[model samples]
Target: MTGSGHISAFSARRAALFALLSGAFLACLALLVSPPPVPEMKSSAIPPPLRADRQVEPSFVHHFGRKHDEATWFKSDFYYPNSGHPAWQADLIHFKKNRVELEVRRRKVAYKNIAGAEYQRRGFYHYGRYEVVMRAAPGSGTVSAMFTHTHGQFGDPHDEIDIEFLGKDLTKMHANYFTNGREHGGIYIPLGFDASKEVHLYAFEWEPGAIRWYVDDRLVHTATPADMAIPQAPGRLMVHLWSGTRDQFNWHGEPTFRNGARARFYCLSYQAAGDDTEQCSDSYTPRKYRR
Candidate 1:
């Protein structure tokens, strides 16, 4: 081959080698100049749905006696002291310990069917979680219930939430909540404490969208808004304790017919709706607390 031909071949080989080296150098630069490897990011986990709020410790909000100026009222409308047909004319007796005791008898009495039924025009209802501490009477054919619910008294679309203790076994507490007059809730939890035997704290917190029932310090049941429409807006707040009934609970497998059974003693504590929010965050000790 001519000298010029030889030079041209060598030039082509050099050009190819230079291109290969440039590519290799670029790869090396990428390995050194790029950002350090990002360790795989770990994500936190979340809780499940339809669960009650966590169990909170015992607390007491201010509870004052009847105030004439205040429109809110919490008076026991019916008291039956003896074993006669239930009527609305029984008297409430005062105890030496400054606690009020009412005689709830087991007798026949006609009650309004409205879930909106009101007591003294003051709508009585409870939507937040509530815990009732009391000792109940023992025996079969006897049904006792403490209600913290919404009734039709104020308006339509009524709701009701109940915590009941039947005869003989106060250790087992039942919880039920209603929405628009339908049975949308149910739970059976061990109080770990007794009802007829001794006095223990029984509570259920009905939050904005859930309900958590408690006994003393133990969390018995947790309910969700999907089950019932609780913490309803503009609903009444009520606290009721009765030993007998002809209501829906009986037909639905509840032990009804409380005969002369008495709710020995009871007290309710709750937070009042503060000025800033429509919810309450206080405790109520009977005749002992003030807002």
Candidate 2:
């Protein structure tokens, strides 16, 4: 009712009006500049894990007839070839045209009766589908094979996956795997056709829970974790031809080195981690992985 009170009330009303307008202006400005809300992507919209149903194109292809030397791709072993006594030579392994040949012959080396040769890929391989197109050698007591193996070192298990052919009969082959330096999961499958007469695609699909073997793309055998211990360590790919001793005659028969023995490989392809698009860039001596 006094003049000063009237003036104060008018000022307060004016301040409240100004504050209301400023807040409204800021709200409108924010709405004008703000971006629209984006919808979140659903889990189903994302890509799924790679499936094992399809056969991927090989990114790593090896044609044995190339000009590269054995040392460039493989390590020649001087150790004994299984049960037979043979010294491996880098010279005995040959690459010509589209074929790689590993020959076994009798040589008088010191006190050892028989001598043979073996070579393994210089690099290590992890989970992969490995395919080798080749013809097994035909001779009594000779064994030709393609396999993946890791030595037990640093308290690690020695793992091996094998596809072996007995020279006594090319119509049958053996598939086996080992875990922790112990052999297990072995099966002998009778191939309908003579492996020595022609080249066929022999392959193994190594996965986490299962391992499958195929001959010419036909599934010949399957090994599960229930069957035996699966290989967990990475290993080198290997091939060799050797004659076994008399004690091993039950598996490879007597070595009749009449004409000698030779295994020929036309091509070898590997799909890393079941992804055919992956390229192999590992050095000759690949990095070893533990467990």
Candidate 3:
């Protein structure tokens, strides 16, 4: 071969090799910056809650107003059913073998006001770790949630943090938060397993400026105040087993329960602002908390 031809071929090969190396380097850099995927572990461990002092005071005053009868009202594990559903009672909430079962069966007498069962904790939790080991019920139109929420009269801003499971699909779950009545952050996380088939620990770390979500102790998602609105008010933790219509904002789908649906809670644990951890129960005196 001529010398010029040999030199031209050698230069072309070197350029091609440089281009390949550059492309590989860029790809590796991108992977390093991207968030890690949800880990596939045989079993994920639930992390303990943070024991830190609260940095901010609660935004709203907690007043235990007009109390209900002693047998049914403000129990730590009991929440009064609102939204036009009043049939919920302590009977529907059962604790056995350290598991809480929030069951909704076909009521023999379908009162116009009774639709489902919901339970909210008595006191409020400000900033800490909220955790639950649960298996969502299986049925469309039904939603199972372990959330913290608070609301005011019409036109007032509200605050909430949620970990919700739609019976429509057990392989996925959704988390959302709101501040001052405006919906801010939301994400759909694939559980990588059937959530109704077994109990899985789901948790969220709540703090002054940030919130993080975890599934079986895996850090799946996180958000900061700059990215989303953070709830400032001290709010009650709640669990719900309710069916919604196609129109509600938190709608899962059309309500359908041939025999009825149920949710099982293996445990609900909370580490509150002062590093106080407690098992949820239904027992509270509203007057004591009244501002």
What's the TM-score of each model vs. the native?
0.54, 0.70, 0.62
The top-ranked prediction according to lDDT is 2
Ranking by lDDT: 2, 3, 1
* Full candidate order by TM-score, most accurate first: 2, 3, 1
Residue 224 local lDDT, model 1: 84
Model 2 ranges with Cα > 4 A deviation: 1-59, 70-72, 75-77, 80-85, 153-156, 278-291
Q: Whole-model lDDT, candidate 1?
A: 0.47
Top model number, TM-score: 2
> Where does candidate 3 clash, by residue pair?
75-282, 75-283, 76-281, 76-282, 76-283, 77-281, 77-282, 158-181
Cα lDDT for residue 199, model 3? 69
The Cα error of candidate 2 at residue 196, in Å, is 0.7
Worst 10 residues of 2 by lDDT: 282-291
Model 3 lDDT tens row, 98-211: 455676655532232234556555445678887776778777666789898767631225888999987777788889998888887558899899777766778898988899
Per-prediction CA RMSD (Å): 25.2, 24.2, 21.4
Better of 2 and 3 by TM-score: 2
